[model samples]
Target: MTLSKAFYLLSPRNFALKSKIPLRSFARGYANSEVLRKTPLYDFHVENGAKMVPFAGYSMPLTYGNVGQVASHHHVRTKAGLFDVSHMVQSNFRGKTATEFLEWLTPSSLSSLKPYSSTLSVLLNEDGGIIDDTIITKHAVDAFYVVTNAGCRDGDLAWIKQKLHEWNSGQGKEGPVEHEVLEDWGLVALQGPEAASYLQSLTSFDLRQLTFGTSAFVPIEGGFNVHIARGGYTGEDGFEISIKPLQTVEVTELLTKVPVQLTGLGARDSLRLEAGMCLYGNDLDETTTPVEAGLSWVIGKERKELGGFIGAETVLKQLKEGPKRRRVGLVVEGAPARQGAKIVEPTTKEELGVITSGIPSPTTGKNIAMGYIKNGHHKKGTQVAVEVRKQLRPATLTPLPFVKANYYRG
Candidate 1:
């Protein structure tokens, strides 16, 4: 029987991963009855009684034990919640022209980035559509740390490897750079208003210096040095810690012991939705431009004029004039508008757009959604209509980030 999201609060204790799929084949779907993918913390998740479910090819915890999605959602907002995000792909690249290489892949200006600082960027296709969205962290002129969603693994890796090969066989250009995938690593996100205070007791490194969008290697209580990044998918102040495989289970146990709760995908979905973050398949793909997704900020000013990267000409032109359709926030009235929901002009019933990512936000108790609207109606507070089931319902062109962000600046 399909259970309502509310019914499984604090679920059953018997949890196990019947199968474990590898990280390389992330695009393939998973089924409980068939093959299932596993993260580095798979064994630990089973031991902790996490309810394993098939998600984006991995057998991940959707909810833990008997704790429901709502309770976990509340815990992360008010206190602290720990998430097993090890399925995400983490890689480090180093060499001269690193910034140039990355700039060719994404529209962001990596050269201007401060050391240890990160920026959200997108890999665009030759047609100006996004191949994948990613986070690029600058350590120095020649070093970078990048993180991409697990769902986009195959496409992203293939693209990068192909580019690397092409760059290596260049016309007497500098040798191609090298990259290492931290494939065996595990990641945990400690998020909430109380996150820093909770994590502060375990590390000697000054958490004060690590602001949002920044990262540093920190020495922890058990003497293990971890890469602590001060940012998260949730809108709250939080950190994403990257740990070695052998230390993962121990670290997860230590962090979730007292005050910290183990949250699952349900809470994560709602939180990211509230934060105005896009899920790859739903909001972005090879057909969508960064400009329409309210991500023009990522396009570097210098890159716009030069236009040498893939889709650079198309993306730059769109930046100068504007995209035909624009992604924007929405407040749906009546039922929650889901992906593929048709958006229409309220009075004339003229088709305008479609919903992309949406959820009934557990934080604010509102039905918030995001979608792409036709060029002219992208402004905030513009009225529109969405077809739910069969009838049209009113929707407001709301400002993004249904909730406000509480990033740690100091």
Candidate 2:
């Protein structure tokens, strides 16, 4: 079976209600025993009844105990959920020319970014294809903290290292930059409606001051000083906390108390889908551009005119002429359209594009999907058809974030 088909069958909707198939069985099927890595919280997860699974070269938790993924997903939407995102790669870049160095790699306007503020940016290739989607936090004019996808670790680091050498050698006029990889760091995401209040009870630093897309060093009640960023993959209000390797277990133990349940990849996937967030391997890839992926806002306005970042030529051209195809949200009528499912014109059945990510939304009670389609067919409310299980299902193009975002903008 295709990967998308397997994923659709193993999705949360199938596990708790439709099938008696155990989630662990599906997890084991994806495991590669030869090279699986473990995060710092691996033991902590097992102690908390987590069902572990191999993902992105790491053995990560799929779900906790007997709680269904739907329940975990809803709990995060209503209350709060703590996720072990330590598998993601975190790095620190510092030097006199750090901002200039980063601007040359990404399309974001890092020079204009306020200290401690963050932006969702993309690392682009020479042809303007997305290398990876990342969250970049500016610590100072000369320092930056970057988080990238776990799956792209090797490629991203290699690319950055090569560029660093070239920039330090001659390209950068200000000074040479240094790159430090935070290996095995413990990164956890505390997400949902009550995230701030629950986190406030543990930290003396006022979370109110740490608004969305911002970060700060906060002192936890237990004497742990860590970095806390006020944003997450879920559309709800949340914080992504980075902890010291030695303090990871203790900090995680403290956070996973009453009202802060442990969440796993299953719930994380569904939650992100409901939020219209893209998954690296499934929804985004190196073959796709940021503009075509509906991430045009990440390209800085000033950078657009000056055109210095990687793939600037292709990106700027697309920005003006528009892409041939565009990523769009869809509300599938019948079955959920998994990745690789064909998108076609409703009437003539002309091939348009293919589905990249989809799920039965627990919140909306609708089968929602994201995919690329011909540009003219991407407008909201445009009628379309998705091929699912060898049948065409009626669908409509819709706006993203099927559920409204609850960001703490203040």
Candidate 3:
């Protein structure tokens, strides 16, 4: 499913009106109403007049009050916005072999990652297809914290457990690894330009020391100590705070006092797209490899040469020769082209590829999209046509991240 389609499927009844997009059937569908789960701050969302919707099997807030998606998107880009991402799965892996086990499952160089530093990594199947994208934080050589997508919860957990069992049963070098799921934990993102200042007011910790991709446990105003990671999906200088279940509501309330609006799925989608981040089910799938998805940087240089991880052969081969298709960003003129839209040669109308995600970016005020096209035609400035609403709209290939990322490197 395309990211837009997935959002539409899980969105509330009034979502079409709010987003100003016509509702249409998608080829891939998600089973809704099977059993919807609630996050720790469900009641908090309701009390604040949030429009709740079913997303990734969780009842999540789509927007707050009467704030339109474009307004929320702009708020996140200019000021600050708070997001309830508690539905995401958080887990801890520990044991003597934890590093080795994770390295085997992914292509990231976990051993070299400094303590409290995080790297975006992907879980690969045997054929190098992406299972799920994850953020792994190294607290110690034997201990690591992982965060994964909520939509892939059951499958991801099952796969990890099965692999853990298999690795534990064998006798190679390091000891058995233990996996612990942090169920009911709260993960909130304080994102945007003013995110750091708002968070600094509530804590004494030196925000300057916590650069992007690094995390630290710090005490907040209410004496609550939480893990604060200095990076977010928005490609802005922000922080993702992980809190205990019992303190979730209080911490969120404290953070949303002023300047930080309660943003939801609607804005989150646009922000991520502008940032050039991939949405799992939409931009990535079991049949897509990381290299093809434009995630080659996640693979460690040593790991690429040594070829220890699963699907390394295919990834290494692609690294050497190049992938048949490459993920690229696009600037479509006239109209916004959404997921499943066809990319074709401008004149001959020959098929090239399909759009996985697209939106009229509030930050850029232009139609932007991300998808894969034939390798040679994926270069910047290459003109192509996108089939939107049965009309071929002119488009040009551009670099990923239509907006300049403002990550605080310091």
Residue 274: error of model 2 in Å? 0.9
Q: Per-residue lDDT of 1-410 in model 3, one digit per residue for the tens?
A: 89988776546645744674322211122365377789999999999988877677777887788898889999989999999999899999999999999999899999899999999999999899999999999999999999999888999999998888888988425699999999999999999999999999999999999999999999999989999999998988899999997999999999997899999888888899999999888889998999899999999989989989889999999999999998999999999988889999999999999998888888888999998898889989999999999999999999988999999988
Would you estimate the TM-scores of all the predictions? 0.91, 0.93, 0.95
RMSD of each: 4.9, 4.2, 3.9
Q: What tens-digit string does per-residue lDDT give for candidate 2 at 185-239?
A: 8999999999899999998888999999999999998899999999999999999
Top candidate, metric lDDT = 3
CA displacement after TM-score superposition, residue 135 of candidate 2 (Å)? 0.3
- Model 3 spans with C-alpha error above 4 angstroms: 1-13, 20-30, 171-173
Residues 1-410, candidate 1: write the lDDT tens digits: 45754334322212111111111122234443656568888988888778766566677787777787778888988898999999889999888877778877788888899999999999888899998899899999899999988777878899988887676567216646887899879999999999899899898888999999999999988878889999999999999999997898888777886688988777887788888988887888889999888898888888788876778878888888999999999988888777789999988888999988666777888778899999998989899998987878788998878899899997
Higher-ranked by lDDT: 2 or 3? 3
Q: What is the alpha-carbon lDDT for the whole of candidate 3?
A: 0.89
- Model 2, total clashes: 0
Higher-scoring candidate on TM-score, 2 or 3? 3
Q: Point to the candidate with the largest TM-score.
A: 3
